[model samples]
Target: MTRAFLLAATACLISQAAFAHAFLDRASPAVGSEVAGSPPALDLTYTEPVEPLFSTIQVTDASGGRVDQGTPKPLDGGHVLSVALKPLLPGVYTVEWHVTSVDTHKTEGHFTFTVKR
Candidate 1:
């Protein structure tokens, strides 16, 4: 019984590792950059390929109000997501994302950036 339990625990750990979702590898306009002008668009790159249909990016203003008007688009590699931003006012903004990898595992995270007038 002890042997069986150990085997089960090992299997569980392996399964969890294998099904882990992709994490943010990098972003353009970066996580905390203060830019002089409005960024033409937002870019996010992940550690692994993500399911385009199951991924989303949401942009919000400093007051926590949603500011993005349209859906995000998947780049060719399937690991990058791009979203067009409206002409933003000088303020802080947060980008929240949720992505499900091709393996069907889900993960989510958020980051912030600021715009200068």
Candidate 2:
């Protein structure tokens, strides 16, 4: 009985750990999407609440020029990060982000979107 209880507890802990990390749930422009016009801002949504003070995002043009206005700001209780953008011309933009979840887990990723003429 003790062994069975220990196994159940171990499984529960492992399952919880699997979801403890903050992962990118979705984003505006929808990762690798192409838009007809420039979006006013880039919005990133995560699976867990993140700490804005410990997060960063960068949007760069195809030529590798930074296009994001500045640092990111949190929204929806830190489940989302919004980054303002400069007026973007027709081109591909890369967004790179690194965020720390409220649980203190760090996650980072990058995606690209294109603006059609």
Candidate 3:
């Protein structure tokens, strides 16, 4: 029974390790951070390399109009995704992102940031 339990545990660990998802590791303006001024771009670093083609990032203001410009640009060897932003005025902004890791697993997340007056 002890030998069988150990074998099962090993299998479980290996199976979990075989799958990967690109989870947000960090950000430029950071999650829920307050900034003094507008950031030219939003930078998101993930736990694994993500595919640019399958990724989408949306930045919007409290009024719900999009502020982000263009497609996501892969940086830091695809682990970091950056998107340009239009000139922003001081207010609360939301960032919504979806990414597909090289393993083809899809992950998504959203956060908010404040630009101080």
Candidate 4:
């Protein structure tokens, strides 16, 4: 009986940990979207609070040139990360992000958005 209880408790803990990592919940310019003009900054919302100091957010133009300025700031109770962006021309931009949750789990992803002329 003790062995069964231990196994069940371990499985529950493992399953909970699997979902504790932060994920991209939303973005200011949004994923795979087109905007009429340039946005001054990029805001990324995560599923959970993240550690800003250990997180990275990079924005690049079509030519793979970095366009993001300054460091990523954690806001909205650490559930959102924002970074300033340089003046963007009418083109596609890629956003790549890596974040570590307060729980110490790491997650990363990339998306693209376009600016229309």
Candidate 5:
């Protein structure tokens, strides 16, 4: 009975690990970066495979308003999430993202960046 209980617990743990969603490993323009030129795009690298259909990235201006003109696209087989930015005035911007892994687990995170005139 004890052996069976141990096996069940181990199975549960393994299942949880397998269903874990990906997380941001790094972001291009590095969070809170200040740049003089307009960033062509925003890049977000994840810790694991992400589902493109359920993953999204948004950039908001310093006033807490969404400035991204369009939707984000997947890069490198859905490992990176990116979006283009319009001409932004010098200010701080926030990047908010929500990603769902192929395994069906979901994760969300946010970061900030700055643009200099």
Candidate 6:
């Protein structure tokens, strides 16, 4: 009975890891980085492929004004998300993202990057 319990526990742990929520793996312009100039767009990479239909990315300046051009677009089979940006002035920009992985797990996060004067 003890052996069966241990096996069941192990299987539970394995399943949890296998169906883990998707998280940010990387970002273009690099998270918390200062760029010499404005990037025309933003790229976000995730640990797993996400469902674009249920995912979102929003960008805002320090003043809380939305700067992202419009809806986010998924690329690279949904592992990467790209969003267009309006002309950015020298300042801090915050990017907020929420994604639902193909596995049906959902997660969200935010980061900031700066443009040099």
For every candidate, C-alpha RMSD to the true structure in Å: 3.5, 1.1, 2.2, 2.0, 3.1, 2.3
Better of 4 and 6 by lDDT: 4
Give model 5's TM-score versus the native structure. 0.80
Per-residue lDDT over 48-70 for candidate 3, one digit per residue giving the tens place of the 0 to 100 score: 89999999999999999999999
For residue 114, model 4's alpha carbon misses the true position, in angstroms, by: 0.4
Per-residue alpha-carbon lDDT of candidate 5 for residues 2-99, written as tens digits (9 for 90 to 100): 99999999999998896586988899879778888778789899888888888888898877787776777888888888888888888888999999
- lDDT tens digits, residues 1-117, model 4? 999999999999998987899999999999999999999999999999999999999999999999999999989999999999999999999999999999999999999999999
Backbone clash total for model 1 is 0
- Give a tens-digit lDDT track for model 2, residues 1-117: 999999999999999998998999999989999999989999999999999999999999999999999789899988999999999999999999999999999999999999999
- Quote the positional error of residue 112 for candidate 5 in Å: 0.5
Model 4 regions more than 4 Å off? 1-11
Instruction: Answer with 4 or 5, whichever has the higher TM-score.
Output: 4
lDDT of all predictions = 0.88, 0.94, 0.95, 0.97, 0.85, 0.93
The model with the greater lDDT, 1 or 6, is 6
Q: Residue by residue across 22-102, what tens digits does model 1's lDDT show?
A: 889899779998989888788899888898798899999988888776877888588898889888899999999999988
Score every model by TM-score. Answer: 0.80, 0.94, 0.89, 0.89, 0.80, 0.87
Better of 2 and 6 by lDDT: 2
- Worst ten in a row by lDDT for model 5: 62-71
Question: In candidate 3, how many Å is residue 52 off?
Answer: 0.4
How well does model 2 score by local distance difference test?
A: 0.94
Top of the candidates by lDDT: 4
Instruction: Tally clashing residue pairs in candidate 4.
Output: 0
